[model samples]
Target: MFDSKHVRVFDEVVRTGSFAAAARNLGYTQPAISQQMKALERSVGSSLFVRVGRGLKLTDAGEVLARHAADILGAISTAQQQMTAIVRLKSGRIRIRAFPSASATLIPSAVASIKNQYPGIRIELSEGEPPDSVEALRRGDCDITLAFTYNTATEQPASDDVFAVPLLDDPLIVLLPVGHPLARRRSVELAQLAEEQWIAGCVRCRSHFVQACAAAGFDPDIGFTTDDNLAVQSLVAAGVGISVMPSMVQSFIRHPKVVSRLVAPAASRTVAAYTLAGNQNVPVTQLMLEALREAAEEMRRGA
Candidate 1:
């Protein structure tokens, strides 16, 4: 039988494609990693890796072992998580990753509710985009994620394993200066601002700008660009340019010099709270999901 420690070292080497990198990942010296790999090869009676020019490549035996190693390592991780949950009893940590807007608008109330009801349970939160957030969940780095997708072909979840609960529909709203002519209107038509100077924000927001403007039969004149929602509002309030921003960012708007109008022929992004489909349900994760849903409902009601 092969040792689990040796297998772990081998897996790391295969993943990194170099002994030196594997050593760094596994907290071992290059010589130590080399020794374990040799021992593993000796036990298996075959070479697992080959030097391919300047880099490393897995041999036929290595490929087979690598596939099995992933399964074994994943099983080990699941077992460890199970043991941790058992030892922690009903109180365990929930790790979450959310985009910036959701972190600002939705997560605060949800986190506060969880803290009030389950004070013993801990919450660890991180901010990341949709792809990175889902990747973190797959790597077992987080249990839940808040991600968004614009209603367009360019925006899609990278992984099929992402199971999401639709939180809210965040529509793009037009931000205009207080004295702008459109400020008097409750809703603005995209075509009405076809010639206006625009301050676009976020990659997806920019894409939406292009799509919405194109549908309105003209291209947008992007005069300024930023990824920050606050900066977008501030610039608009300064009478610099008009902007289209997500409704969630309304929570961050403190400037009284700007007016937000809902856009007709509405384009919107779907905000979803998600987790890996294979994620094990624990008490803490369940409670956190419930809290997020409750907070999202409150926000929807207020909107």
Candidate 2:
């Protein structure tokens, strides 16, 4: 019979793509991981991996096992959570991951509320971009993931097994230096700034900015590229270049010298929370989701 422990380790190796990484994630030594993989191969009577350049690629048998392993692990996780709920609801952990802005804005309130209500229940958070966070969720690294997409129809999770709940529409806004001529305007149309130099945060954000600009009939003259919103604000404040950013940024931090104006025609991204479809009704997850909805509603009311 195949050992479930060995199968778990094998699954981790496939998810992490390297024995060393799997070792670190699962708290095992590198050599131990290799030994276990060898044992697993002997038991299954097939080599599970092949060397492709400096990286390891899964063999046909490995691919089959990996697919089954994901379902097996997910079932195991669900079972464990259900069992934990029976023992006690107040003493458990929910792992969550989110993109940066939501981490700063929404997570704090939700986490605080959860902690205050159930002090014994622990909530852990990690930050990453939507793609990375979604990948982490798929690998069972996080229970909930907060993500956003400028185009909801195209950017949402394609897998039917993942459940997505729309939280808020984070409108794109223009950020300009305090002394800029456009700073005094209550709303800046995208076409009005067609000739101005632009600052973009990340590839995905830049793509959205470009699309919005294109819709307004101009290609932006991108002068600077960065992924840090604070740096983008600093650049805008210094009169380096104007920026297009989501409204959530203002809730986190704002540069005093930067003036924000709503974009005319109102482009926005939809922020959503994702989880395994099967986990939607899990008690702790439901509680956290409710907290997020409450926080989102408050933000909407205040805006």
Candidate 3:
């Protein structure tokens, strides 16, 4: 119940042996020091000092408090210093959850940049799909999430509890075997592949693909489903099935026998950094977001 300020004054009085001396040291009036001492005594419910002929003497309770004062003050001081370091970007930790493709592409560069710039920061990364990553963020298991949403009119907006930072748009690119009839074309239309077996990506992506195919007037015959970019490309290379994925994923993992072409009616996903509402402004979070934005910019330029 005792205030830290009052405890500080009490400790100073104990050290100096007089209210006037403690006040002089602390830059407070003697009466102010006396009032703080009285408040501290009331909080502890014990008499802390006794007058011993023009000098102050510590009572039993005062001795007990004095013994622990230095440790308490030292802990408070350490906490303050650590907080300052975090605010100044000198030291901190950021836990990030991102989807697989992004983890392989954007995350590596962004994390590396942040680590190189702020060596004292500790970054931990985990891979998950957008839904899982966002769940982890809301559960307070991660500081930031790298997620993507299919660019569609039906795509839901982020909830009120989350803040989304726009990174870059990753266009949906179709993957086909090198010798496939449409492989050499500048782009492929969804309707042209109505009879082709399909390899689907993640659940969200698969759903988007189906809807796009439906809009193009046919139901896709999906033969395999996997969230792995390398697996998707490998499947496409072997001519097992054609697939569509974010351009970022295609760029990160390319197969010699697989060719990518932009999809007609050009669908894409919006890649973003997601955080708890208001966490975007935190110094460490803000720094990581900036790194992500820069990485996205580089990818955009290269694309």
Candidates 2 and 3 compared: the better one by lDDT is 3
273, model 2: CA deviation in Å? 0.6
Q: Compared with the true structure, what per-residue lDDT tens digits does model 1 show for residues 194-218? A: 8899998877568767987898899
lDDT of 3 by residue, 172-279 (tens): 889899999998999999999999999997778888889899999999999999877788888888888999887888777679999899999888888899999999
Q: On lDDT, who's better, 1 or 3?
A: 3
The TM-score values for the models, in the order shown, are: 0.69, 0.71, 0.94
Ranking by TM-score: 3, 2, 1
1 versus 2: better TM-score goes to: 2
lDDT of each: 0.84, 0.88, 0.89
Off by over 4 Å in 2: 1-88
Between candidates 2 and 3, the TM-score winner: 3
Candidate 2 clashes: the total is 1
Model 3's alpha-carbon lDDT is 0.89
Query: Cα lDDT of model 2 overall?
Result: 0.88
